[model samples]
Target: MVRRGVLGYVLVLVGGLVVSVLPASSAVASLPLVADLRSSTGGRMLGLAVVVVGLGLASSAWLRLVRAAGDLGVREDDRTALVHRATAAWTLPLLLAPPLFSRDGWSYAAQGVLTHLGLSPYVWTPSILDGQVVEAVDPMWLATATPYGPLPLVWGSAAAGLTTDPWLLVVAHRLLALVGLALLAWAVPRLSRWSRVDPARASALVLASPLVLAHGVGGVHNDLLMAGLAAVALVVAARHGWLVGALVVGLGVAVKLPAGVAGVGVVLVTLPAAARVSARATRATQVGAVSLLTVVCIGAVSHLGVGWVHALGVPGEVQTPLSVSTQLGRLAHLLTGADLVDAFRTAGSVLLVVVAVTVGLRSRSGDRRTALRATAAVALALVVLSPVVHHWYVLWCLPFLAAVELPARGWQALLHASWLGGLVAPLDSSLRGADAVIAVGVAVVAATALVQAVGHRRAEIRAEVRAGAQARTGDASPTSPISR
Candidate 1:
């Protein structure tokens, strides 16, 4: 057991080191070393291969660590602590690594520079800036307005106050992301217990997840901060009262609009199990009022106003396969030979609203478990039906889902998806032409092997459960030594 833990830690650490050497999308072109590597076809190909391999190693290590935490011999508290320790140790290598899967970290820094210049990010694009900071932003987004909430801009502005160097700015963004990871570590166990799920398993599922490591930490996405705040809000609401939860979730919403879904959850969980429909309605109203007021206050203090709400459509400008709506639109266009992408996307938005409303209404019975599950469902719906989707968007629903008890197959699917999400980072990066093809091929092979391994593990788990049951039955027999 000790050996396996050590091996997993070492594997992930080494993987992080290998991946960190590759040039990031936002790497300064003037850097002699980076320019030399980028100019070489052979170097690019080799770097791509190394990144794929590194991601695989890290993902495999994460799987091993998660499984080890599930050892029946370990106490729940010990298991939770072990996962936490593993997460902290594994994060060390990537803590200062270049942005692994996405260039959003650089964009964040650029936005902060904009904020510091007294320009509203929602009103101005990074293109307005001059110097290294603007150069670090993705060209595609250079002229596009930011879709993120005002609170994130404020956070970025704070980081900008420290330095204007793009690299240091990215590192600062990463450090801020760590604050969110810490919040998740603190909240997941409590939420798991509330939902009657195993705290250790939940911790491993959310904290040690490759998705969290590769994107939440490595990519420096604001989704991590939003998720942590939402989780803490739910826990606080359940403990203190719905009012506090509203305040906390409002902060989350100020980070990202999708987090407002948790506000509904806070209201549901705070209601009495046998509360009347009228009571549910009244509770929802109060929570909604408090949450709205909090968000307004945050916007006012940030001085960015609410222009971000209008700019939420910014992400839809770029179409990616990750979006279910986009796929559906493509399928429709192919079938009818008509440009139905926009129409289909609009329908998806409407459908999302319907599904969220249905889930929220059904959880009015006030069962905390059901309320939590409902919140997860709403978050899932938001991602699936949105006009645009990013790999890290899964963070929105992950914490809530991790807290809920799932079937064996459900857990297996979620685990595999999380690992695969991290492993697919290369494809999401700036790799083009041959490098992209190689990434796709490697991802396919890795995904297949992962599925097979999980299937085998599932069989072993079933066998163990059967054996344990039989042993207990034998011990209960009249002629057995213990029975005698």
Candidate 2:
């Protein structure tokens, strides 16, 4: 145990050190940690190399936690605390440094600046902060209004109120992410109980994930807070009744629209056990009340009024190749010589609704497990089918996925591979677009293939064990031999 802890700590600290030494993301004009490290030809390559090595170390630490977790349903000392410590150690360095690998953090700061100035973040672009704030924001988002929900905008405004220093505003966002991590740490144990998974392993998977650390805390994305709230809501609904669940999930929705799925799941899982007409009527009424209450409350608190409704669709306007919908749109455009982004996005939204309906319909009466799994499915499907797939978006699904058991090893590895690839994708752009796509593609393929191979081996071992047990039973007792 001591050895494992030491190794994890070492790997995490090394990764943190690497992050400290590397330059800030190329997208931002200036970063506190990289002020001295100007963008030179060789310096850029060295920075990329450092990123690769640091991420590798981080991955190793995560794998070690997984292996050490073993098959125990409950661990002896509850190493999740250790994992959290490691996460903190890993996060501290990045928090002090500029946002690594993405300029979205800068946009977040710029939005906060606008909010502090008593401006509607949903209405105004970062252009209003025309001097340093505009320079801090990526040009792509400079002219575009913020797509974030009202709660985050409020929090950002509060952070910006602390100091006019753009860097300090960024730090405030990171601190908010740390608070989210705290919420996650509290929720993971309860979720493991609900899902019947090992508490330690689930905590490690959700809390200590490289994607969570790198994109979540390091990028200072508000998705972390949304997901943490969603997880807490799921657990509360499982332990308490749907009313409490609805309220908490509504709070999450106030933070981000994506979290609305939690509210939907809460309602689905509250279906009555008897399946009687009366029972169904009662359940439907309760759900409707919860839903209405959530909507009214959320609308009331939305300082930006209904303008955020328009801003909600802003992400769809940007066609990054990362999204499956955008990928299909590109393919369709290539084939038909017309832009199909809107059509593809519409299809994606339809598919998301279908997934929700399917989950709701298939949920067995009085089965919390089925409902929770459906919730997880909805969360994952939302990100997968969305028109804009940021790496941080994947964080929306991790807690839910951690709560449930993945059906197959290959599928589990595939999920990890997806997020792992997401973590590395930004590094490619940071490398001045020098073969990042191909490199990430090759890394993903190789990692998934390796996982598949290991999964097959585990399957064979289980098969042999079952076969041996059956053969031993036949040899020991009345294996009624062929009478003929």
RMSD of each: 4.6, 6.6
- Per lDDT, the best of the predicted structures is 1
Cα lDDT computed for each candidate against the true fold: 0.75, 0.66
The C-alpha TM-scores of every prediction are: 0.88, 0.81
Residues 1-484, model 2: lDDT tens digits: 3343334334333333333322233333355434433344344344444455455555555655554443333343556666666666666656665565566777888888888898887788887776555555666678887766667777788887787666677788888788788889888777767667666667777777778877777677788888998888877776788888877776677677788777656765666663554554565467556744665565567455545667787777667767898899889999999989788988998999898776666566566677678878899899999878877787788887777866556335644653375346345333344564335434643564466446544744664465457668774222111000
Candidate 2: stretches off by over 4 Å: 1-37, 71-77, 274-302, 422-425, 428-484
Q: Rate residue 136 of model 2 by lDDT.
A: 50
Q: Tell me the deviation in Å of residue 181 in model 2.
A: 1.8
